[model samples]
Target: MPSYKLTYFDGRALGEPIRMILTYMGLEFEDNRIDMESWTALQKEIKWGRIPVLEIDGKEMYQSRAIMRYLAKQAKLAGDNDWEAYEIDCAAGTVGDLIDLYRSMWKLSDEKTKEEWEKKLLDEFIPSFMKNWDEQAKNTGFLANGKLSWADLYLHGWVETLEVLMGKEIVNEYPNLKLGREKVHATPGIKEWLAKRPKTVY
Candidate 1:
């Protein structure tokens, strides 16, 4: 087995999709959670000033999206051809938009800002995302080829993270989105993987 290491902060953030790929594959890897100070200190030590760098067999890989696609390849979950891969990437990009939106609100540190953020997050962004993704899920079902792909798994992980962050069950509003989440999560590999999945407290 190839040795792997994923570095990130406490919350799910950029590294979660890679983690989910590793988990679904039941691959053993190191999870490095660094603090703000540690990230600042370690930035100079890595190839790039990024915390979400993935190291495999002593070679460092930067860029979260690239690392995720690589891990998906290793997990044999990326699509069959280049076009299919592009579709998978497109699906992942949709989730990326939602994640960025959540991150912006998550940065608020005050009661009023947080309250305003919570309202805006649920009222403005979340529902819009649900509508878009729900339609995509209904039409595409999976990211590419109507088969489970890296994008499917990442979508599941990103949605799960959103639910945790949102502090409520939100996907019920969209049946296709809910079904998509369940399909990826219920895959034999993913189901078995989730059973022994290591818990991360953040």
Candidate 2:
């Protein structure tokens, strides 16, 4: 097995799913958490100046989704075939778009603006994602395919982040999505990780 080292901030954010994938695959890798004060000096050393850098056998790769997709393939959680993998990517990418929207809302300084944006998010953006995903989950009992895949992990993480931002139950209205997230958590490796992982606000 190739050696792996994942570097990110001390929060779950974009890093947790990668960690979960490693843990699920029973792969041992260094989980390096950087401090905010040290980031400036370390920024030059990091590829793309981004957190969640995955170092494999001393070689480095950036981008959280890329890292996850690569690891998912290694772990055989990506999908059964090329087409299945494409669907998996579609599901994960949709969740990524939702995450981007949530992050944009986080940047608003005015409470009124934030509230208005959030209203639109909850009313339209979030529901659109959930509606599509809920349908998919209903048919597959998973997010991408009829079996467990990396897309489920991405969705699980996305929902967790959304809950933190929305400050309420966001998945309740979508039963399939809610159950899909629960199923991801119930997977043995993920279940164990969640039980012992450090608690964080995000």
Candidate 3:
């Protein structure tokens, strides 16, 4: 078995899905959480000066989504076939779009403007995405292939982040999405990991 070592910040923002994928695969890995001081010291050696880098058998791999997809294939969670993989990618891409949109709010300098952007994100943008995803969940509980896939884990991680950003549980308002998130949380390996994983503010 390849030795796995994940290097990331102490939080879950962009690293949780990759961690979830590895944990769900029953893979033992070094959860190498680092602080800002450590990151600053290590930045010179890191590719692109960013993290959530996975060292597979000592070969480094960067990019969180790329790592998740690679591990998903090994976990048998990518999809059963090509078209299904395409669907999973579509969902993952949409989730990435939402994450980027949320993160962009932090770039605004003006407090009032940032507040306005956040309000719109919480009100219009999130609901729009939720409505569509809720429908998708209603049809296919797993979000893509009517079975568990990495896309579902990806969505679950995003939803967890959204809850932290919103300061409350919003998934309950979207029943199907709530159910779908529950399904992902209930998967055996994932359930165990959630129970044991270190708690973070996200």
Specify the highest-lDDT model's number: 3
Off by over 4 Å in 1: 35-37, 106-114, 139-143
- Cα TM-score of candidate 2: 0.90
12-129: candidate 2 lDDT, tens digit per residue: 7788888888888887889888888888888987767878888899899888899899889888999889999999999899989988998898799999999999998989999898
lDDT value for candidate 2? 0.84
**Candidate 3 local Cα displacement, residue 134, angstroms:** 0.9
- In the range 106-202, model 3's lDDT, one tens digit per residue, is 8999999999999999888888988888888885567787888888888887678778977977788988888888888898888999899899887
Instruction: Supply the TM-score for candidate 3.
Output: 0.95
Model 2 lDDT-worst window of ten: 156-165
The candidate with the higher lDDT, 1 or 3, is 3
Minimal lDDT window, size 10, model 1: 193-202
Model 1: per-residue lDDT, tens digit, 1-202?
Answer: 7998888886665667677788777777898878788888898888868768888987899977787888788777777888888888887887778778888876888989989988998998989877877777785466556778887777776676678778878887888877777787787766776676556543
Predicted structure with the largest TM-score when compared to the true one: 3
Q: Rank the candidates by TM-score, best first.
A: 3, 2, 1
lDDT of 2 at 76: 94
**What's model 1's TM-score?**
0.82
Clash number for each model? 0, 0, 0
> If ranked by lDDT, best first, what sequence of candidates would result?
3, 2, 1
